[model samples]
Target: MKKSIVIFGSTGNLTYKKLLPAIDNLIRQKRLKKDDRVYLLARHDISLKQYIEDAKKQVKEMLDWTVLEEVLEFVYFHLNQIEDYQKLNHRLKDSGYTDNVFYLALPPKLFPEVAKGISASGLVTKGDASKRIVFEKPFGENLESARTINRELWRYFDESQIYRIDHYLGKEMIQNILVVRFANRIFGQTWNHNTIRNIVIIAKETEGVMSRGNYYDKIGALKDMLQSHLLQMAALIGMTRPKTFQSEDIKDAKVKVLNDLKLDSSSVVFGQYNGYLDENKIADDSQTETFIFAKAHFMNDKWRGTPIYFITGKKLDEKRSEIIINFKDDTNLNQIFSNAKPNNTKLVFKVAPEDGVKFQLNVKQPGLSDEIISGHLDYCHTCNWVGNTTEAYEKLLFDVLNNNKTLFTRWDEIEVMWEIISEIQHMNIPLHVYDDFDHLKEIILTEKGVDIDAL
Candidate 1:
C-alpha cells in the first residue's frame, strides 16, 4: 500500500531537522517505497522549490534531493480554515494517495483545530487506524487540560489511531531498557526494592533556552522535562515486566508504574538558572524553573519504599541523560574484613551524548592487602556502532509508518503522568535560584539529603 505523510507545520524546525530527515532515511533504508508521498502543509505561502531549498540549508545531513523531490509536495495550508483541509483532501485523492499519517508539528493549542479540520474535511474515515494522527508533546498544561485535549482528540479519532509521541521513548537505549531488564537474568532477578537502594534519573543541559526562551519560560523544566521525558524514563526503569512485549501490555505496565508514583511539596525542589531572567522573551520576575529535583517513590509492592529521584536542569551542567540504579552495599564484607568499606554496586544506563551501560562491582585491588575497589564492566553502545545507530526521530517516524505504538505513549500513561505533575503543581513548591551545577547539587543534598556522587 502506498503511504502518504501529511505534515502540518512542515516548515518548522522539527519538520526540517527531524521529520523530513527521518523520511529521507526511511527511503534510503528501502522502508519507504518509491510511491510513498510526503505532503508538506504549512501556513506560509512558499513554493515547493523554495521550501526544498530552505530544507537543504537547514537539514544537517547530505540529503538525496532527487528522492525527496520525487516524493515531496508542498500545500499552502491555513490551520483553522475548513476549506483548506477540504482542498488538501482533494489533493491527496487526486494524487492517488490513501493510508495517510497526519504529523501535527504545530503548537499544542492548534491540535484540536487541526484534528477537527482533518476529520470534518473527510480526510480520515471514523475508526480507521490506517489513517493515524501524530501529536507532539507538552500534551497539555495540566491534568484537566490534558483531559480536555484527550477528549477533543477522541471525538475525531479512536484511541488506537492516535499516536502521542514522546521522542525520548524512541531512543535506542530507551527501547533497550525492555531487553536489558526482561531479557537479562542477572538484572531481572535483582530489579526490585530488596536489592536496589535507590534509582536516579538525570537529564542535564549546559545551554539555556536559545530561541525557545518564550516557550521554555512558560513551560519550565518541571513540565517540559519531568512531566514527559523523565517520568517516561522512570516508568520504563521502574515498571514491572509486561506480560508480553505488545504495545498494549507495555503501556499497561508503564501506566501501572506511573499511577504508583508519589510526590510531595517537601519532596520537590525547583530552581531557576542565574541568568534565566535576562533571556529573550522571559519575564523579569519569572518564577519558572530551569531546574527540578524531586524525590519520588512507588506505592507498589515491588518497588515500595524504594527512593526514585528525578533531576533535570538547564545551563547548570554538561549535557547528559542517564539512569543510575544503586544496589545496597554489602554489609557482611565489614564483618569479614575489619578495614573494608564496600562500594555499592551500580547499574548505569547512559541515554544521551552517548548510549551505553556500566555495571560497577567491588573487586579486590591488585597487590591485595585485602583491599577492595570498584571495577566497572562498561559497554559503549555508540562507540561500537558510531554512525550506524538510528536517530530517535528516524526510529519514531518508521514506527509511525508501520503503525507500531510500542514506542509511542498511550493516553492512559499521559493521564497518569499529568496527575503526577498536577500533584506537584498543587503543592505550591517554592522555586529557588541557583548559580551553577555545583550549587544546585549542594541544594539537593542539603534539602533532600540525596548525594549526587552516590547516585
Candidate 2:
C-alpha cells in the first residue's frame, strides 16, 4: 500500500538531522515504495528545493537526492488552523494516499492541537491500524500531564495507531539486550539477584546543553534521560523473559519491571554543572539538574535486593552509553586457589560511541604460575562495518511502516515511567553543583557513600 508521511515541525533539528537522513536511507534501501510521498509540513512555507538544500547542509551524510526529490513534497501547516488540516487531507486523498503516518516532531505542547486538528479534518480514520502517529520523548512534564496527553491522543486515535517512540529502544545494542539474555542459557540462568551484585546504567555526554538550554532547563536530566531512556534500559535489563517476542508480550514484560521498580530516595544525587546558569536562555537561579544518579531496586522476587544504579549527565565525561552488570564474587574461588583473590566478573553492553559487548572473566596466568587475572572477551558490533548497521531512526521508521510496534513504546509503559518520575520529583532532592564526572562521583561517594566506580 502507498503511504503518505506528514512530518510536523519539519523545520526543526530532528526533522533535518535524523528524520530526513533516515528517510533518505530508507529510500536507498528501497523500503519505501516509489509511489510513497513525504509531506514536509511547517508553520511557514518553504519550497521543496530549499528544504532539501537546507537539510543537505544540516545532514552530514550524502543523501540520495535523485530518489529523495522524486518522493518529497512540501505543505504549509498551521497547528491551530482547522482549514490547513482540511487542505492537507484533501491533498493526501487527492493523491490516492490513505495509509498515512503523522510524525509529530513538534513539541509536546502542540501534540493535542495536532491530534484534534487531524481528527476534526478527517485526515485519519479512527481505530484504523493503517494510519499511525509518532511522538517523541519527554512525553509530558509529569505523570498527570502524560496522562492528559495520552487522553487527548486517545480521543482521536486508537492505542494501536499511536507510536510513542523511544529511539533508544531502536539502537542495535538496546535491541540486542533481549537476545543476549533470553537466547543465551549461560546469562539467562543466572540473571537474578542471587548472582548479580549490582547493575549500573550510564549515559554521559561531554557537551553541555548547547542550544537546548531552554528545553533542558524545563526538564532536567531526570525527566529527559532517566525517565525515558535510562528507565527503559533498566526495564529491558530487569524484566522477566516475555512469553513471546511479539510487541504486546514484550511490553507486558517491560511494564512488570517498571511496576516492580522502587526508587531509593536516600541514594539519589542531583547536580548542576558549573556555569550552567550562564548558558544561553538559562535562568540565573535555575535549580535544574544537569546530572542525576539514583539507585533503585525491584520489588519482585527475581530481582529483589539487587540495586540498579541509573546515572546520566551532560558536560561530565566522554560521550558514552553502557550497561554494566557486576556479578557477585565467588567465595569458593578464594578457597580453591590459595594465591588467587576473587575476581569480580562483569558483563558490559556498550551502546554508543561503539556498539559491542564485553565480558570480564577470570583467567589463569599465561606462565606456569597458578595466579589468576581478569581478562576481557570483547565483541565489537561496529568496528569494521561502518555503514552496514542501520541507524536507530531508520530502523524505527521502517518498523512504523511495517506496523511492527515492538520497538515503539506503549502507553502503559509511558504511564508507569511517568509515575516513577513523579515519585522522584516529590523527593525534593537538593540540586548540587559539580565540575565533571569525577567530581560528581566524589560527591556521590561522600554524600551517598556509594562508590559508583567500583560498581
Candidate 3:
C-alpha cells in the first residue's frame, strides 16, 4: 500500500527547493503511486491548491523547468496550530490512511516541539502503517541539548521512528568515500598502516551567512560542519573495516569513532571571522563563529601517526569542498626531492559547486622532457548520470515513507559527535580574525591554541 507523507516545515527551504521538486520528479516518473497522499504543514493559512501552485512556481524558479507541475493533485496544505490536540487528530484522521510519515524540515528548535505536538495530538499513534519524523543538521548545541531533543522527540516517537537527517551522508562524494577506499585495490592496499601521511578535509564556502545570523551564531563552524559533515567523512576514511556494508555495520563503525575520540588534543584549533560581522543585522556582541580549523588524531594501529586535518569556514577564497589525502613522501633520497617536488597523491572528492572525484598522481607531464610531473584525471559526474537521483530531501522523504531508518543517525552517534565538539568548544581557543587574502599565512603563524597558522 502507498504511504501518506505529511511534510512539516512545508514552506522551509528543504520543502520548496528540494523535497517538492523531488516529489514532482518521482510523480513524473510514476514512482509515487496514485494512492499516495502528500500533505504540507506550515504555519500560514493556505488552501491545498494555493500550496501546490506556490510549490510549482518555486520549483520552476529555484530548480529545473522540467519539474514544474501543471496541477499537483496529491498534495494538501493546512495551517498548523500544533497545540490544538483535537483539531490535529481530527484533521490527520481525515486522511483515511494510516501509512503516515511526518517530515520535520523546520528549524532545530522546533524539532522537539513539533514532535511533542504531534504526539499530543495522537497523530503518531493514529498511523496504521508507520510513524516517522525527519530533521536536519545541528541536532543540538551540545550533548546536553542533544539528549534533551532526543527526550522531546521520544515523547512523540521512539528512537526507531526518528530520522535525523545528515546531508553529508546523502552527498554523492561523501558516500563515495567508502566506495573509493574499499573498492579500489591500489588505494585499499596502502590505505593504512604506514603508507598514508595525512588526511585533510576542507569545506570552504565563498559566501557568508546571508540571513542566518542568529542561527549561525548559536551554532558555529564546529557544531555546524565539523561535528556533522567533516566527521562523517573522517569516520568513513578512518574507521576499521566493517564486517559488512549493511547499514548497521556502516553506522556501527561510525559510532565507534565518535565514541573513541580523544578530547585532549593539542592538535585542535578553532577560529572566528571578523569582516562578516558587518553583514549580520544582529548586535556586535554576537559571538557566532565563521571559521574553524582543527586536527583530530586516531591513535589506532593502522591510522596512528596519520594526521586528520579539518578546515571549514564561511566568507572564504574559493567555493571548493574536498578531501586531500597526502601520501607518505619518500623521494628525498632522489633528485626529485632536491627539486622540491613532493610526491603527494591527493584523492580529491569534490563535494559542492561540483560533485566528482579525481586522483592527482605524479604522471608524466607529457611532451618534450622526460622529467616527472603531476597532473589529474577526473571522473566527472555528467549532468545526465544523476539526472534522476533524488535530492537529499527526496531520498530522505522516501526513507520516511518506506519507514527506513538506515540513513538516520542513532542517538548514540549524536551524543558522541556532540561529546567531541563540546570539549573543543569548552576550551574556547582564542580566535584569530583575518582577511580573505592573507588568511592562510595568518593562520600558519599563530601559536598553538592561539594560532590559525598551525593549519
Candidate 4:
C-alpha cells in the first residue's frame, strides 16, 4: 500500500531544511519506498513544479537520480486554505492512497484549530485506521494548553494513530541509551542510586537565537529544552528495564520514570543571555530564559538520592550535548594515601559534535609514587568508518513511515512533562542574567558549588 504524506507547513524552515532532506535521503538510502505519494501543502503561491525544483536543490546533488525521479513523480502540492481539509480527502482518494500521514510543521498554537478542521472536514474515514498524524513539539505552552490540544486530537484519531515527534529520541546514541544500560552488566549493575552519585545532561550551543527570536522569546529554554528533550533523556536513564525492546514497553518504562519525577525548587536555576533583548523582534522587557539548570530526581528505589542535572544554554562556549554519570568514589582509597583525593568514575554519552561514549577512570599515575589521576577510555563512532551519520529527522521519518513508535513521544509522556514544568513555572525561581559563557559558569560554580569547567 502506498502512503500519502501531507506536510502542513511545507514552506517552513523545518520542512525545507530537515523534513524534505530527510525524505530524500531516506529514498536515496532505499529506506523509503520510491513510489509513496507525498503531498506538500502550504499557503505559498508557487506551482508544484517550481516547489519540486526548489526542494530538489535543498536536497543537494545526491546521485540517486533513479529513486529521486521516482519520488518526484509521486509528489504533489496544494495551496492550503480553510476548506483545504475537505479538499484533502478528495485529493488523497483521487490519488488512490487511502492511507495518509499528516505532518504538522506549523506553530504549536495552530495545532488545535488545524486538528478541529481536519476532524470536521471528514479527512479521517470512519473505518480507516491508516490515517496518522505527526506533531512537532513544544506540544503546548503549558499543561492546560497541552491537555486542550490532546483533547482535540483525541476527537479525531486514536492514540495509536498519532505520532508526537521529538528528534532527540531519534538520535542513534539516544536510542542506544537502552543498549548501554541493559546490554552491559558493568553499567547496569551500578545503574542504581546506590552506586551512581549524580547524572548531568548538558546541551550547550555556541549560537544564539538568530531569526527564531520570536519563537524563542515565547517558549524559552525551559519549554524548549528542559521540559522536553532533557526530560525524555532522564526518563530513559531512570526507568527500570523494559520487558522488551518494543515501543510500548519502552514507553511504559519511560512513563514510569516521568510519573516518579520529583523536582527540587531550590535545585532549579533559569538564566538569560545579556544581549538576548537586542535580538531582532525581541522585546526589551522580555524575561524569557535562554539558559536553564535544574536538578531532577526520581522518587523510586532505584534512583533515590540521585540528582539528575538538566542544563542547556544558547550562545555558550561551544556546541555539545552530553550525559555524564558520576559514580560514587571508592571509600577504601585511603589504602593508597591517608588523605587520598576522591576521583569518582564517570560514564559519558557524548551526543553531538561527536557521537561516542567515554569512561573516566581513576588509575595509578605511571612510573611514580602511588598517586592516582583520571583517565578517559573513549569510543568515537565517526572517527574512522562511514559517510555522514543519519540525521535525527531521517531516523524519525523512517519510524513514522514504518509505524514504529519507538522513537516518537507519547501524549502521556508529554502531559506529565508539561505538568512538571508548570509546577516549576509557578515556583517563583529567579532567572539569573549573565553576560557570557564565563560569567554563566562563574555563577553556576558560586551558587551550585559545582564545577562547570570539569564537566
Query: Which candidate tops TM-score?
Result: 2
- Which runs of model 3 end up more than 4 angstroms from their true locations? 49-85, 126-129, 263-269, 331-340, 383-386, 448-455
> Which residue ranges in model 4 land beyond 4 Å of their true spot?
52-82, 337-341, 368-370, 384-388, 453-455
Q: How accurate is candidate 4 locally (lDDT)?
A: 0.81
Q: Which lDDT tens digits does candidate 4 get at residues 1-455?
A: 88767788886778877887787788778776766876777666676667767776655545454555565432333333546777677777787877678889999898877777777777764335787788999898999989988998887788888899889998878988889889998876788998998889999998989878888899999999988999998998888988898999999989988999987777677889888889998988998989988777898888888888888999888899999998887777667554444655889998897898899887777796777777789988778767867889998887787778889988999999987788888777787788777887787788887676664
- Measured with C-alpha atoms, the lDDT of residue 309 in candidate 3 is 80
Residue by residue across 327-385, what tens digits does model 1's lDDT show?
Answer: 88666867876655455588999998889899888777889467777789999887867
Note the Cα lDDT for every prediction shown: 0.88, 0.90, 0.70, 0.81
| TM-score on alpha carbons, each prediction | 0.96, 0.97, 0.87, 0.92
Q: List runs of model 2 lying over 4 Å from the truth.
A: 338-343, 384-387
Give the winner by lDDT: 3 or 4. Answer: 4
Ranking by lDDT: 2, 1, 4, 3
TM-score of 4: 0.92
Best by lDDT: 2
Give the per-residue lDDT of model 3 (tens digit) for 300-407. 677777777888888788888888777776646255544334644667778877887887777665789666677787877556595555556666666667767767
RMSD of 2: 1.4
lDDT of 2 by residue, 1-455 (tens): 79878899988988888998899888888898789999999877789888888777777778888889899998877889999999999988888998889999988888999999999999887898888999988798999999999998898999999999899999999999999998999987899989998899999999999977888889999998999999999999999989999999999999998998988878899999999999999999999999999999989899878899999999977999999999887768777866654536899999998899999988888988877878889999888775768999999999998888999999999999988878789878888888878998898999999987778
- Candidate 3, residue 282: how far the Cα is off, in Å: 2.6
